[model samples]
Target: MSVQEPEARATAVSPLGTLSLHVTGASGVTIDVAQAQVPKLPEGMAVDGVMLICVRLAVQITRESPMRIRATADQDGHPETGEWLESMAFANGAGRLQVAMRDDAWLAARGVAAEPVQYERQGFSQVIHEAPAGTALYVSAAWRIDCATAAGDVSAWFAADLALPA
Candidate 1:
């Protein structure tokens, strides 16, 4: 019997409601994300009056040594609404890794009241465990948005790339 080596994998979820990513120089990497809608609102705010937004991201590196992962958010809103947020870079990591964003300031700036709601970890993915001297991978982040003054949810996948430092 023979054993197989792990390869680098890239995965991500962007605020644009899309999930897309790629891995190069390695193989056998996987990613996953889970999002939840805010079911309740603060005082004087109804589900329709407040927007519930959550972004879940996770990455796992099975191989040893170091690997670089980058996440970015491009485009905002969706087919239904105009772009409300701009694309932003999120993270870069190497080795067994995990990343997420649940800052109150981030939520408040997006028009969501920074009260009465708590964010939680939602999803995760795994990167290849082993790689040669140089390896690169990328994954898009996942995004979930609850529309203000509307009752709905938006989800999609974007694109991202990875690179190994010299």
Candidate 2:
């Protein structure tokens, strides 16, 4: 995508209210919910009555500059600045999970450098077990773009009621 106009903000939401992402300022970034699911675990890795929230983020950063981005997912309250989940593995034998950005040739061809990344979590195990499905949970992401012409901070989040599979 092209560089966002300075101070401009954009928001996109999934059709089911399962998740969403947005951005602000001239960071030249956009976010979308690529996937949101309660993944099925392998027989041994499964935990009775427990479920996990996995969210894949489609992020595009077009501005060429070093940037620092942080992402997290959890229950109830919004994630704090320090609660960064840059890399994490699911609990209870649910295998590994991560949100990593890669170089995208598609974006590169158009002059953008970074590929979008996904976000997910089992960090709210207690909430999963205790709260009924449809309770609100949040996924937070923030970015600090450092290009000389577009130095600013942009943040995004998703506040969705959990949709647990039957």
> Whose TM-score is greatest here?
1
Q: Count the clashes in each prediction.
A: 22, 2
lDDT of 2 by residue, 1-166 (tens): 7864332222322221122222232233333333343344434222112122322223332343232233333322221221122222221122122212221333244343333333334222111112122222224222112223211111111111122222
Clashing residue pairs found in predicted model 2: 57-118, 59-116
Q: 157, model 1: CA deviation in Å? A: 19
Query: Candidate 2 — worst ten consecutive residues by lDDT sum?
Result: 152-161
TM-score of each: 0.26, 0.24
Candidate 1: tens digits of C-alpha lDDT, residues 22-133: 2332333344343333333334433211111222222332334323233323322222211222123222221011122222243345333222112112232232333332
